[model samples]
Target chain A: MKYINHEELLKMEPQYRVQVINSLSGFKSANLIGTRDENNINNLAIFSSVFHLGASPALVGFISRPDSVDRHTLRNIQQIGQFTINQVNADFWQAAHQTSARYSDGECEFKQTGLTPHFIDNSDAPFVKESQLKYALKLNEIVPIRLNNTLLVIGEITDILCDKAAIKADGYIDIESLNTVMVSGLDSYHTSKRLSRLSYAKPGILPTKISLDGKS
Target chain B: MKYINHEELLKMEPQYRVQVINSLSGFKSANLIGTRDENNINNLAIFSSVFHLGASPALVGFISRPDSVDRHTLRNIQQIGQFTINQVNADFWQAAHQTSARYSDGECEFKQTGLTPHFIDNSDAPFVKESQLKYALKLNEIVPIRLNNTLLVIGEITDILCDKAAIKADGYIDIESLNTVMVSGLDSYHTSKRLSRLSYAKPGILPTKISLDGKS
Candidate 1:
C-alpha cells in the first residue's frame, strides 16, 4: 500500500494533486446540467458531483465552482432559477464530456458538440435530447462553502421524463439497462454492471438479493 | 417516454417515491465512513452521498441525515473531529450495505458487518481493513441544509492509503481497477467497466481517449 500524508499531498504538483484529490471521492454520477440564461442561451456542462439530498421533496444537489468552466452554468441557473439534469449514457458520453470545454458566454455547448437541445413546456431550461433519463429542477437554494469558495446548489425536481421501460414496478429506474455512465476523477468515464440489488438491511438478518421488479 | 410531473411524484407512495427520487440522482459513490465516539465505540455507516468538494485543500463532503442511520456517523464525527472514508469494493459491498442497519448506540457496525477496523497513529477514526483505497479526514465544516434538515459535513484529507498499482502516472487512481462499487436507488450495487479516460475538452476539438499511462 502507498501512504501519502497531509504534507506530502500538499507538496504534490498542482495538476497531480487535483487528480488525486478528485479521484479520492470515488465514482461519481455523470450528468449534463442544462440551463438557459435570461438571454435564452442554452448551457450544458458535465458534472460528477450531483448527489441526492432528499426524497419527499425530491431535492438534488451539485457542487459548482464559481471560477471554473462551471461558471456559466452557475451564472445561468441563478439567472433563470431553473435547470435540467440529464444522465449521460454510453451513446453520447464523448459529446457530453465535450460540453465541459470552456466556451464563451455567447456559445452553446449543444451546438458545439452536435447534441440537440430539448425543450419542455413547464421550464425554460433545456434538456439533452440524447439522454434517456432527464429531469427539470427549480433552484431552491445556493449554500456557499466558505472553506473552498464553491457553492452547493440545491434544486427541487419539478418534472421528470424517462423511457417507460426503464421504470420497474417498485419505482427503481434500471439505469444500467439505460447504459448510464459514471465518472471518476475529472476525465474518466465508466459504464457499470449490476451486482444485484440487496434487500433492505435489518439488525438481526442479512440482506439477500432482490428482484429488479417489484415482486420481491 | 414517460413524464412525471411534480404533483404526480408527490402523490406516489412514500416507498415508491423514495426509490424513484433516489434513482434519479443516477449512480453514486459507495463509501463506508468510519468514526469513533468519545466512549471508544467505533461507528461505521455506508454513505452514497459523499462527493468531491475541492482539490487544493483536498476537501471532501458528504450528506448526513440527522434522524437516520447516519446520525451515529454525524454524532461521532462531531465528537472526535475526524473520520475515515473507505471506498466500498466489489468483494465487500454486501457487508458494506449491512452496515446501514439501524444498530443501537452501543452497537458497532464493524462488528455486526464483520468488517475489520484498522487504526493508525495519527487519528482515532477506524478505517476499513478490506478497502483497497482509504483516506483519513479531519472535520472542516458542517453546513446545515435547512430545506431538508440534512447536514453537509466537509472534511480535509490528512492521510491516504491505497494499493500503489491503482495509481496511474499522472495521479488518477484507477478506481475501476480497484474494484470499487457504485450504488443506485439505495440498494443496488454495481461494479464498473472503464469506458475511457478522455483528454481535456477544448471548444472546437473533440476529446479523444487518453491512455491510462498519461503519456499522451
Candidate 2:
C-alpha cells in the first residue's frame, strides 16, 4: 500500500494534484448542465459534481467553480432561474466532453458540439435531444462555501423525461439498460455492468440479491 | 418516453419517490464514512453522496440528512473533528451496506458488520482494513442548507492510503483495477469497465483517447 501525507500532497504539481484529488473520491455522476443566456443563446457544459441532495423536495446540488472568471452556466441560472441536467451516455460522451472547452460567451456549445437542443413544454432552458434520461430543474438556492470560494447551486426537479421501460416497478431506473456513462477524474470514462441489488439490511439477516423485475 | 411533472412526482409514495429520485441522478460514489464518538466508539455508515469540492486545498464534502433523527456520523464528526472515507469494493459491499442500519449511539457498526477497524499513524478515526483505498479528513467547515434543513460537511484531506499499482503516471486512479463498486438509488451495486480517457479539450482540436501507458 502507498501512503501520502498532507505535506506530500500539497507539494505535488498543480495539474497532477487536481487529477489525483478528483479521482480520489471515486466514480462521479456524469451530466451536462444546459442553460441559456439572456439572448436565448444556449450554453452546455459537462459536470460530474451533481449529486442527489434530498428526495422529498427532489433537490439536487452541484459545485460551481469560483466566479472570479466567467461562468456562463451560473450566470444563466441566476438570470433565467432554470436549467436542465441531462445524463451523458455512450453515444455522445465525446461531444459532451468538448463542452468543457473555454468557448466565448456568445457561442453556443450545443451548436458547436453537434448536439441538438430542444425546449420541452416551453421550458426556460434547453434539453439535449440525444440524451436518453434528462430532467429540468428550477433554481432553488445558492449556498456559498467561504472555505474554497465555490458555490453550491441547489435546484428542485420540475420535470423529467425518460424511457418508461427503464423504470422498474419500485421506481429504480435501470441505468445499465440506458448505457449511461460514468466519469473518473477529469478525462476517464466508464460503462458499468450491474453487480446486484441487495435487500434492505437487517440486524441478523443476510441480504440476498433482489431481481430487477421487482422480486425480492 | 415517460414525462413526469412536478405535481405527479410529489404525489408518489415516499419510498418509491426515494428510489426514483436517488437513481435519477445516475451512478454515485460508494463509500463508508468512519468516525468515532466522544467515548472512542467507532461508527461506520455507507454513503453515496460524497463528491469532490476542490483540488487546490484538496477538499471534499458530503450531505447529512436533517437532524430530526439520530445521526451518529454527523455527531461524531462534530465532536471528534475528523473522519475517514473508504471506497466500497466488491469484497465487502454487503458488510458495508449493513452499516446503514440504525445502530445505537454507543454501539460500533464496525464490529457488528464484521469489518476490521485499524488506526493509521494514531489517527483519531478508524479506517476499514478491508478497503483498498481510503483517506483521512479533518473537519473544515459546516454549511447548512436551509432549503432542506440538511448540512453539508466539508473536510480537508490529511492522509491517504491506497494500492500504488492502481495509480497512473498522470495521477488518475484506475478504479477498475481497484474493483470499486458504484451505487444507484439505495441498493443497486455495479462494477465498471474503462471506456477511454480523452486528452484535454482545446478550441479547435478534437480530443483523442490517451493510453494508460502514457501514449497519446
Tens-digit per-residue lDDT, A97-163, candidate 2: 8888888887889888999998888478999999888999999999999988899999999998998
lDDT of 1 by residue, B76-163 (tens): 9999999999999998999999999999999999899999999988889999999999999999999999997999999999999999
Supply the DockQ value of model 1: 0.90
TM-score list, all predictions: 0.99, 0.97
10 residues in a row with least lDDT, candidate 1 chain B: B207-216
Q: In candidate 1, residue B53 scores what lDDT?
A: 92
Pairs that clash in candidate 2: none
What digit string (tens of lDDT, one per residue) describes model 2 on residues B1-216? Answer: 899998899999998888889987889999999999989899899989999999989999999985622288899999999999999999998998888876676678888989999898847999999999999999999999998889999999999998999888988888778899999878999999888998887767777899874359
Give the candidate number with the greatest DockQ: 1
lDDT of 1 at B165: 98
lDDT at position A187, candidate 1 = 91
